[model samples]
Target chain A: MSTEIDKSKVVLYSYWRSSCSWRVRIALAYKKIKYEYHAIHLLKDGGQQKTDEYAHINPMKAIPALIIDGHIIGQSLAIMEYLEEYRPENPLLPKDLYARAIVRQMMQIIGSDIQPLQNLKVLQTVAEFTGQEEKKAEWAKRWIANGFNGLEKLLEKHSGQFCYGDQVSFADLCLPAQVYNANRFNVDMSHYPLIQKINKHLATIPEFIEALPSNQPDAEVQC
Target chain B: MSTEIDKSKVVLYSYWRSSCSWRVRIALAYKKIKYEYHAIHLLKDGGQQKTDEYAHINPMKAIPALIIDGHIIGQSLAIMEYLEEYRPENPLLPKDLYARAIVRQMMQIIGSDIQPLQNLKVLQTVAEFTGQEEKKAEWAKRWIANGFNGLEKLLEKHSGQFCYGDQVSFADLCLPAQVYNANRFNVDMSHYPLIQKINKHLATIPEFIEALPSNQPDAEVQC
Candidate 1:
């Protein structure tokens, strides 16, 4: 039975080095899904993300909003989970409920607990609280170090080849992205040996390699 | 054929007025799952959650860690999603792909974007940046107001009786919890007509009412 093809392609509104967008890109590549990449520069021209045009796409005005069939979905975790539910192939989460919970737990540790504290917008607002212009990279490193300390301890037992076990899961997807940001902030990776180790291994995977910030169409030579 | 009753009991390590904990409570009540509640005070004796015992339970040392059959799961989003997957009944998330993505999106908006910025630990760390012990509730109100402004616009189109629609999903589970915190922070809910309306309505529901922080065993009479 020939079914209707989805002509409305998946368009990812992403910033080149965005950890969230990198996670989604890895998920898409792992699922072997095709997508059109739209680079929405996060820092150029007072952040293209803050423009009225992007706000119409995501009122949150965040990058990594996945547009499919004209329906836009924001939030990286949501976008990745949507792909899992929509395709259910090349599963990013484990089959067992308990195991999947652990994967989700690890992802949330980074996603909810860690990354939000280090977000671009959140960092941009840090000067208001500091009563002076704070170093953006310093703010990022502070939060990343704090969160990664907790994450490193959590990964002690659960981590095998990846965050959970032998197979790559959602935790693996989230780790690389956060690690990318960690490197950018000059966070001491030595403090998180396991995280650094797992991140090192994930870099070798084809999916992770393809989704690297340097591999993106919007990749820029950083000074 | 009669199904065997599961012998393993569910135990939740939670704190009263913890928005993340409240979210998991609502999901458990909505699922009608019998569970033991262990109150892990977030702000007592230098924060009980920072204790060694709680650290053993959840390495991340966060609240709302579900212990079932000797296995533990931390993070409210993970716990709620675990409930959805473990039982797959009384679904808090819609089964349809697009619908579920939006629910998760709204949940992430509240879970990742809003609440983390206002978390007890995050607020406690504000002194590091500000050089003075800041007003905790004031800080909470600031981030809540910023996030709600964006959320209000998103709800303008999607909201019906709930954040998504008439049917209560994970978005519904998340909204009430964050709204509960919003009240504590004295965030002006009047600015968010749709959010205020939905929150008021959610109060009438048994699940939400039962999950109220005031109804919990550890609830203290606020002076």
Candidate 2:
């Protein structure tokens, strides 16, 4: 069933290097939803997210906000689930409720567990508290290791060709961006073969490749 | 339709003072699902969550794990969503997709934004880094204030009687538990009248009232 909402008018407020933004971008691509990418430099002039224009789009002053037919949706996980609901032709979730729960669990591991610990503000706090740049990196590495260890164990039980199974759900969309961030911080994925394997497979997907931070035009100029 | 699964056979591995566990407790009460609560002392014996048995239940070594028909589900948000799926009669999400997205966003704000910052590990890290109890509390207060400010703004727009209008969603299950933790740390809620109001409303509810940390069987007994 086609949604009554107009498809051509959809726009995504995103930052090139934000993993959360990349999750939504991958979801849009997977669902074949055509959307205009409106880049918002998160670090420019004390962050464009705090600006009036962006705040009007998302009161929370966060990235990965979706504007569909004038209605705004914030939060990357929420946006991906919304896309799955509106555009069900190319489904992102599994048919069974149990399977869907497993997929959502995977999303939560990244969305809730990993991403928040390494967020910009948390990094800043780590720097302030420790008064050492190396200590901040260590803090980031610690949380990443903790989250990835749990993820690796969970993936051991359920992973097939992807994080959930053979099909690519929202979990697949999350893994690449997180793996990319981890790589930047020099996280040792060699201990997590399943994660490394999934990352390798996701890298070959056109949707994942196109959504890479380096692929964005604004990423070239580095704000 | 009554699920074939027996509610009485359910067992919840929880910690009385843990906000995450309290979230699951509220969900169980809301659904009227019968279950035995097995308390895990988060602080005692150097965190009982790291014990062999608890690790078997949840490799993540987190509290608020639900064991149903021999299968285990971890993460408070995921557990509540799973409950809503199986016990759809007491729905925690709205019928409309947009409405559901709003509910999920509220959950995200608590699950991702607020809860993690003040969690045990983060708090301990702050104390370790600062080498002062007062400074750690200050760190806690700062993040909580930032999160609550954003939450209050979002609540102003969406709240009616609860976090997302009249009917309680998964968001309600999360907010009270989190707010309770913030209150324990003496983070004043005077600024967020909407949150304070909702906190009062939630407190009066039988399910929420019964799920309080003070009301737990393990409350008086030191871990």
Candidate 3:
């Protein structure tokens, strides 16, 4: 089933700390896909993502656009889906249709419902609107809590050792990055016992652990 | 390949003006899948979506949750994907994996990147942040324009009469609703020629026309 596309050209444009970027990294790791990594410092140089050179790669000015199978796929979900289709082994989706939909629903609880509102750009906008720097964290925490509240409820029906059943699905890829972001915003995880339980277990998985922001080449060494 | 679930149980919880709801509407119409439409007025009674009953249907508390095949699928993209997998006839996704990925990338440009940031709750939050009722449209327009700018670029490479080639993929389902929302916000579409062209073509589609917000059972019938 190999195509004419060269495998060596696969590259991932990513930022060390971006949640969306982390999701793709975990997907790549979990699938054991190989790729070259190019760090796009989202906060450095007025966002390297906003530059003309980067715009040629992704007009959305977003990170984690993967160049694979001779195509540039933007959006983490799109990229992950492409990978799932490109290499079907160690599938990120479940075998059953209902389970797959539930996994996607859990993923969107973070992807659509939560992450967009609390991203770096939106937080910066909130700060500008209120003229108060502290409002940034407050704003991020509110949306995180709001989405986690729904996510925990869904987890009650769907979660086992992971966000779905015992298998680590696409939803689990989203969990660690979001929980990391929530901790930064001082979101109390005690309210989301199911999420806390699953995230705790995910921390021990090599696929999740290897994709941690701290493990990335561009990660800033903390003081 | 028929399922045991009753087709009569297929239901869609939707709001007339909701962009995400409209996306699923178009998908269902395109596929000719029959379902019961239950309107959840997002603005009435402090949002019918906030009720505990609605939470059971979708803990994310969003509209366009489809109850089909004896399963409740939340998130427009998730539901749409479920639909694509559930009924392979008149598929919303392309057969080619690269084409499927491209369609998804175009869809996410609206789904993940644009729509979430400009939805009802986020707009209300924006108004509360600035204490100016006018900032709501301004905020919505900004994100819509930002996303459309990228989308138009992608369309240049992918579009023919529709968003990707002449065939209507899932990306086309997202177009009319977003264009309708953009028009409401007064986003100058002159900058996005490709989007404007594709949107114009999509209007002639029966599936799209039938799913227009104004065509729904609960439409407010604006003066």
- Tens-digit lDDT track for model 3 on A5-31? 334598888988999999999999988
The candidate that wins on DockQ is 3
- Clash pairs for candidate 2: none
What would the per-residue lDDT of candidate 1 be over residues A1-223, giving only the tens digit for each residue? 0123233788888988898998999999988888888899988898888887778777788878887765788899999999898888899999998899999998998899889888877777676667666566777887788778777877897889898888999999999878878888898888899998998899899999999888988999641
TM-score ranking, high to low: 3, 2, 1
Off by over 4 Å in 1: A1-7, A134-138, B1-8, B134-138
Clashes counted in candidate 1 amount to 0
Where in model 2 is the C-alpha error above 4 Å? A1-8, A221-223, B1-8, B221-223
Docking class of 1: medium
TM-score of every model versus the real structure:
0.93, 0.93, 0.95
lDDT of 2 by residue, A76-120 (tens): 888888889888977888887777777787788888878988888
**Candidate 3's C-alpha lDDT?**
0.88
C-alpha lDDT (0 to 100) for residue A133 of candidate 3: 93
lDDT agreement of model 2 with the native: 0.81
Best by TM-score: 3
CAPRI-style quality class for the chain A–B interface of candidate 3:
medium
TM-score of 1: 0.93
Q: Model 2 - which docking category?
A: medium
